[model samples]
Target chain A: MTDTAIEAADLTLAYGRRREPALRGCSFRLATGRVCALVGPNGAGKSTLLALAAGLLRPTSGRLAVLGTTPAAARPRVAYVAQDKPLHPGLSVAETLRLGAELNAGSWDAALAAQVAADGELDPGARVRSLSGGQRTRLALALALGKRAELLLLDEPMADLDPLARNRLMGTLMAEAAEHGTTVVMSSHIIGELADACDHLLLVSGGRVRLGGGIDDLVHAHALVTGTGRVADLARHTVVESRATGRGLTALIRTDGPVDPAWDVEEPSLEELLLAHLRAPDAPALITPGTTPTRAVAA
Target chain B: MVEYRIDRRSGVATYLQIVQQTRQALRLGLLEPGDKLPTAREVVEATAVNPNTVLKAYRELEREGLVEARRGLGTFVRRSLGGAPADTPLHGELLEWATRARAAGLDREDTAALFAAVLEEKFPQPHAAPEQAVPQPQPPPERTLPQPQSVPHGTTTEGDPA
Candidate 1:
């Protein structure tokens, strides 16, 4: 088994006692050296989990570890780029890299930082305040890349980038991660380009992990079943989302047992699966690998 | 270097698609031994996929003895597939049979069923699963399961008062 880069067991974090915990009983192990995509709708505890993993926030109760140690211990080796891609407005492009090098101490790679500057087409002398939003994001990423951290936590790194810039940045980050064997955990919209870049998936909803595992294993286990009439036999499978398809009903379901022969079962597209989970916030979870995936009645 | 393209939404997995594309290239004479596969960066630039994904595909190919990853250099094709081209003698023979099947007024699905039955009869493997041995490449246009004989049971169950 691969070592977990991050682990949370019975973890709960709440900003205020009266407010719903941003995260509740959140538990999942992200394997080392894999690019993982964290997906959920707004206010679904995604950002809270990332913040917790970054040591920026402390849990109210329960345990969380990054790289087999507490997040505080892992902080120096972990690089987190926030959703806003924050940067010092007065610093020039060159100065930002220099600041990054200083902050990261001995781990900084000045050459990689220079190459990113060139690729982003930012003049070393250009001030951050003068750069466009996309340019600032590129510079923010350049600093993150220069750190050469063991774990890179990115929050929607491509949100502001154009398609071409997004592709180039993803390519650079992926190649760099591969060359360095760094683990990357990035959060993105439920439907984002380059999701295929992530090999593992962690879906959080309703303040808990709805499902988490290798992308292939999850996709292969679930199916899109379509059939006429309510499939009473399928009442036992963990139905995620279902709707009337004019004449028949189409439903996405997670199952280890046999499906009723009445339905035409096909593998679900990645988008279909994600939308299913997002559409049904209370969709029964398949969190722990060995637990029987909870079944739901036709809805 | 060979370019890798993948469908992010298709039933096929991206890495599996990469593996299949590499194998297809080998069979098509497009990729040969000693040719370097696209670097992880090249693949990411073209496909915008996870770099680890490309590396995983390469590792799979290596495990299958099709390619080898050299440290600090790049992954290389280990050997030629040395198999027949995509269009084998069997393909030409199938085309000839298709013409006869059409003249005989067999519908698309009827032709497939006939072919499946013949294949099952002539080349049945002792240990293969029923579906694999029959090799139905397409999902049946109509529902293939819930055999007609079993329909009455479901109908009766529906008729039962809950």
Candidate 2:
């Protein structure tokens, strides 16, 4: 099987005949056994992309694969938790878990499900409707954990969770990744929180890919340069965002070559860098796997 | 007993931040030899960071001889930076000198600049021996810490931390 958990080539999709495409020409490769964070503004098709990966929606045109199989074919091996974390309200937590186990009979992990329940402080006897939002999220994650699927596609998995619960869930998820080599794709609006868990990134905006690559390479390639006189025009790097400072221009730029010695250069935080790319959605994406920006993404 | 907390807003890498918090705790004598560090799972749960990130930080500390991992128990502090408190004789002299410099009307930044310059002159750095040729200075404790080892540069860039 291919090492990539998700791969798409010129993927595009539209909801209806006259509707604007929810995703446009999206292409990227997310390696197996890595946690990738998906981030963008609301209405930027983040949900659409997750749904597509989970086999809930078909790409209108172009090829997409999950776990080296078509998303639909991979459904049995992939566990997906929607934003709402849908579960039967009348069922007790134990019953909910029991139902998930029944549905995923061949691969269900009772131990993992129990661990998640314990971490979230869930009582299996409690009814789903009596649970808090965070508790419901926990139950949804527990259901996913019990499935023991190879790839997990989670949309805002931590949204309803408190900070402590969120951290615990991420910790549990990370342990799963390390122990079992599971590939996870999680969409979150919390940039800092996402940066902590995801080593790779796939940033989308307005239904188009803004950038994609290892987070370290992406961060290292870009820098914040503050210097005198039209620093934005620095020849080597691609200026992502530029602003006038008291003395001159301070810009966030992507540099493959050495930054000029005159500028006061600092590494931009992930949030700053992500926000810059998201702010300039029209700028051409730099599909970088390493230092050299070798691929030119289609416009 | 020092718990590492990651400030996501900071430019520091997660592992480096963990290392810095440990070192900072050491400097303040909050963490002593034989004290246990939070387990990898515990850190991951508290910080919401990748488990590997926590392991990487602990590994870095182990490499530095600052902490040791016993078989399945937990990581423990092996030693400390052993900095003296601010009231030490060396600091007393520095404070006395600072008062005189202030009386001479040196602004805060100027005083700091002049003090750094004087310290560098008086304690000229050791001549670069074969082993000491690299000139990378340690980052200030407050600045965003970096882990050249954890964060590798693409294509082996010259300024890459490693």
RMSD of each: 11.9, 7.9
lDDT of 1 at A130: 97
Regions more than 4 Å wrong, model 1: A288-299, B7-12, B27-30, B39-42, B59-74, B78-162
Instruction: Give the per-residue Cα lDDT of candidate 1 at A111.
Output: 89
Question: What are the per-residue Cα lDDT tens digits for candidate 1 across B1-162?
Answer: 678877865656677788879978876668776788988877876777877677777877777666778897888876655445567676687789998999999999999999999877875644445652321112212112221222221111112111
Please identify model 2 stretches exceeding 4 Å from their true place.
A290-299, B1-3, B9-11, B23-39, B62-162
DockQ of all candidate complexes: 0.24, 0.25
The alpha-carbon lDDT assigned to residue B131 of candidate 1 equals 54
Q: Per-residue lDDT for B1-162 in model 2, tens only?
A: 667788876756789899989988876678877789987766766677777778888887887667789997889877665545445576787788999989999999999999788766665544423343322222222232232333221122123111
What is the per-residue lDDT of model 1 for residues A114-190, given as tens digits with 9 covering 90 to 100? 88778889989999999998888888888888888888898888889888888788878778766777899888874
Best candidate according to lDDT: 2
Question: What docking grade does candidate 2 earn?
Answer: acceptable
User: Candidate 2 local accuracy as lDDT?
Assistant: 0.79
Model 2 error, position B95 (Å):
12
- Number of colliding residue pairs in model 2: 0
